[model samples]
Target: MTNNQRTEAVYIHIPFCTNKCFYCDFNSYVLKDQPVMDYLRALDHEMELTVKAHPPGAIKSIFVGGGTPTVLKPDEMEYFLHSVKRHFPVWSDDIEFSMEANPGTTDLEKLKVMREGGVNRISFGVQAFQNSLLSGIGRIHDTDDVYRSLDNARAAGFDNMSIDLMFGLPNQTLEMLAESVDKALELRLPHYSIYSLKVEENTLFHTMYQKNQLPLPDEEDELNMYLLLMERMKAAGYKQYEISNFAKPGYESRHNMTYWRNEDYYGLGAGAHGYINRQRHVNIKGVNPYNEAARTGLPRLESFEVSREEAMEDFLMVGLRVLDGISRTRFEQQFDASLDEVFKRPLSKMVSAGLLETTEDGYRLSSKGILFGNEVFAEFIGTLSAN
Candidate 1:
């Protein structure tokens, strides 16, 4: 409860993938000819240095994300997982250790290593069920690979599982999205994350969009697709915990909730960003540079202490992503100021515009607000001037 309390969550990033997806702008590289084991060792070294600097409490959640964490070989996976366990020795009894995997990369042996190494949750990157759509997005696996991977994961004793799906894809139809959804629901998995495609810079899709080559769904079609999916998910008994994530009861992603709840967590690996002790740090991005820097000390690209005002803004921006919204008491507890007093103007404007509604303990996005969430979040930015 003190200012110096350690964070209870850890995020380890593995920036290697079998192949780069056309739409992905994540900090990951193709696995071919990369220094995979060396990077893992450097990751281990980074963890040791980090723990020494900021000793952790019992970890509640640990998430391993990346281009494709499953791309690691069985021995490599064991070494990386062992390093994690060794560095963060203390763990809660119900700790949620999750890893991101690509459908084609994970096999039975690899899944067994992950399961035996204490990874209880496996989130597969099965972006679409249709083969053509998958290829259009530069995804390596087909629909059959998805089913096989799920079977292997279940055989590996991972009951807590999730899959990532996408809509608004280039050349994608609403009916295609519906088919993907129906297939996803057929599995009856514990969690499902369906996201709309975003054409971020430096990606293949971005170039296609620039040249007007990307056949994307128009605004009206995309909106209808969103509404349809929301209705389908609701009817299927999934809770839309966050704007882009849904889950069965008691199966929500605790590790991601740590980020949405705006709590501190350690970020390891190249290009990983971590916020701890009121400061945020981003590691060096290149593989060689990160490994070299780790030998000397913390491989930090940038580290800055977060100001109180910045923290409050971040709390509102990220915390509001959750459907439950921000708690007034918790805000006051965190900043020692009334949330209403600090953000009265924007809150009033948004509430009046029917974008935000008052909750018993806090404020949450109205139904319309969820649709235009970016607009609502924009109102909070730069409202409070630094004193």
Candidate 2:
């Protein structure tokens, strides 16, 4: 088979967590029973096979995401980093190497090891500031640990730092959300990813929601919180580049932008997803399954060829999630079809309904559209031939 001739991004998933958060649906397990060394070996074997076949280089970004990446010891971090450096073959200057950490699990030594190991960006998951809300969501860290971790990161010479915060939790209110944003802005980090709580099925939050025991803010309250956050973040001079992420100028996450821009990224680790050269595939889900497969070959993949029509819809859907909206030029360039020709029907309907507006080179969701984003996205689904 011919190799795909496309520049790609890399995502390395570390699936070991100190403990599971009630709201998390990610493929992470409690570390007690996990085979850490064996997992690493499996991951290394996968890397060897991938690099030998594809020889990935000119990499734009590498995001080491989690089940809490900081759960790995500093030395363990070194082993992984070294593997990445050897296999990916990145230039020293342009690459963005980002790692996600839970606030309580990081320390100065760990941060130092990571920074020196070539991790230029650090994103901490500091979900909420209030201890009451933190415990309510089953987060392992308190507010103090958040600040402490930040201090440790700064001391380790990480200038480009981002913190992930969440609002609209169980029993959370607009006022509380405002305070969370207020607290976050005070830190003056380069980037902040503030997301609303999403309770997915099979999680503890979902179970509570079914029993009517989940103390969630009502719909109106959630909308109020969302609007308030936009105002505050705008006033604070952070650009809402995406629905849930805000960053200072030039500090936007290049790694994540690859996803929002609907570009290819190699997703490594158990339960990771990838869209490489227009084919979408998922890695095996469980840790042991992934490990066993990688030592042999990647297993349990559900792979599909992305048809040209499906690609256009996908580009519109994921790219629209970026606050800047979808690029008509880019859609045409990628799929060899004009955006208008492909999405004329939904585009017209959405525009008439005041959901999307035409920009110079593309279209962006209007105020009403963002509020009802899912509804807007659904219009572009099914088939573009209806246009």
Candidate 3:
């Protein structure tokens, strides 16, 4: 593929995990007996071919997300990072290089290699502070492991760190969530991402839900959990930059913002998805198939151009996720039609219903709309079908 637009962000997916979580529907597999090295080499090859085809503008962000990137041994991590540096040689001076880690998987040696290899930020998957809750979710790490891992990460020269927490867990209570929040705030890390557990298809949680065996929190309790967390985060002085993410000033996740802003990015590795040159491409998902295909060429399972209408819908859906909302000028510039002209009906309806508040520059979710974001987003869908 030829392109004049310079891609500035890259997302690398690692498909191997120590163990799959009960609720995770992500494309990840358990790491035992897997062709780990071969997959890395294939990923290297994919990056080589991709950069050559699309080239790049000084990449501003690189996110290594996974089944668990830290699961790679020190030498393996070194080799993997070497391949990354070799392929995407040019990076901005302040490039946000981030890697996702599982608490139990990281050690001093591995973290040292990761830091020295250009990983400036580490996000640990510390789902909760309670040991029972941790095991209930199939996570190996307990509260103690969370502390040890953070200490090791800091010792390895990583001060830019973040931890992920989850609420509305099985058998979780309001008091338990409050304790988790208190512990997370006590860490005083630069960023924190707390999400509610969604029972997705093909996961253990889904099966349990089908059998009416999952002990999930009721709607009222879940809503209270969200409200409580937001209140706590604000009181603690972290900006609610995104619905699920909070950060100190200048510490928001630039890589994730790239997606919420509906910009193009290169997705590499098995089961990765990329949006470039107006088309979206998904790579072959299975590890073996991806490795084989990468040896020859792009391991793409599908690549299709995104329709203009579809792009507009995506712009509204994702842009609203950010606290800043969608820019009317940007929408007009991108589509060459006024945002009002394009989404007049939904815009009017949402505003009248107090779900959206119009600003001089754009439209954003009203305070009430933030709580009912899905409903607001749904209004934008299919509005262009009549056009």
Candidate 4:
């Protein structure tokens, strides 16, 4: 592959959790009785096959995500990290290797193992600061666990850290969210990802909504919670780099930026999704199935090519999610066509409606548009022809 086409980002999925969260819909299973070692071996096989097939560039970012990456024992973590280095050994000097951890899961020993194995950044799932709220949402960690986990990470020589907070949960009030934000800021972490609760199908929240048992905050309350967070984060000197993410200067999540910028990345392990050379594939989801499949070849459930028109739509949709918006230069470079010339109608319409504003070389969401970003993004999807 050419320099521009070689994948530089990787996403590895660790599909075992001590327990599933009530609101989670990710492809993760309970840790008990699962073939953890077998799964790791299968992941190693997948990495070997992936590099042989695609031949990665010097990887710039690698993100290890759910069910909870920290649930792995020290030995397991070491083996997994070794396998990663063996396959994609070449790394960018400033590579960001991040692993998602659940609070209360990472002790000093395990964290030391992680840091020694090359993980530099840690993102803890500290959903809420209140113990009551934490239990209500099925989180296994309390506020104390959050503090202890951060301390452990720091003691193990990690300075780049982030914590996640959630808003718009069941029984979550504006005051509650405000309190959570205050506690999260008190940690003085470099980054924060604050998101609203979404009741997706197959989740406990979804079932409760069907039975009218979920006492979620009203729409107006949820909007207030979002506004409060944006104002608080800004006042605290963190940039709202993305709608949901806040960072201190250079601490923005580079791995996630690869996705927002619509760049190619390798997705390894069970149930992971990868995009390479305009083609996307999702691996087999089940643990045993993935292990069995990887014994022979890539454990892909499905893979397909992405058309140019569809790719353009995706560029606008995800790129606009970033506060920087879409760059005409990048759009042209990727598709060899003028951004304005192709999407003139929607661009003109959104700009005229005060939802989008022109930048020096691109268009971004206006302050007003940021509140209704989903509506603005909707105007681009399915609007292009395959030709």
TM-scores vs. true structure, each candidate:
0.99, 0.97, 0.98, 0.98
Instruction: Summarize candidate 2's per-residue lDDT along 94-137 as a digit string, tens digits.
Output: 78889999998989999998988889999999887889999988
Candidate 1 global lDDT? 0.92
Q: Write the per-residue lDDT of candidate 3 for residues 34-116, one digit (tens) a residue.
A: 89999999999999999898888899999999789899999999999999999888999999999999998999999999999
Clashing pairs in 4: none
Model 3 pairs in collision = none
Give lDDT: candidate 2, residue 74.
Answer: 80
lDDT of 4 by residue, 1-387 (tens): 124577999999999998888899999999999999999999999999999999989999999998999999999999999999999999999999999999999999999999999999999999888888889989999888889999999999999999999998888888888999998999899999999899999998899999999999999998889999999999999999998999999999999999998899999999999999889899999999999999999999999988889989999999999998899999998889999999999999999999999999999999889899999999998889444
| Ranking of candidates on TM-score, top first | 1, 4, 3, 2
lDDT for model 4: 0.94
What's the TM for model 1? 0.99
Candidate 1 local lDDT, 134-216, one digit each (tens): 99999989999999999999998999999999999988899999999999999999899999999999999999999999999
lDDT comparing candidate 3 with the true structure: 0.92
How far out, in Å, is residue 371 in model 4? 1.0
Please give the lDDT score at residue 155 for candidate 1: 94
Cα-based lDDT for every prediction = 0.92, 0.85, 0.92, 0.94
Which candidate should be chosen as best, given lDDT against the real structure? 4
Off by over 4 Å in 1: 385-387
Cα displacement (angstroms), candidate 2, residue 338, comes to: 0.9
Cα miss at 150, model 2 (Å)?
0.3
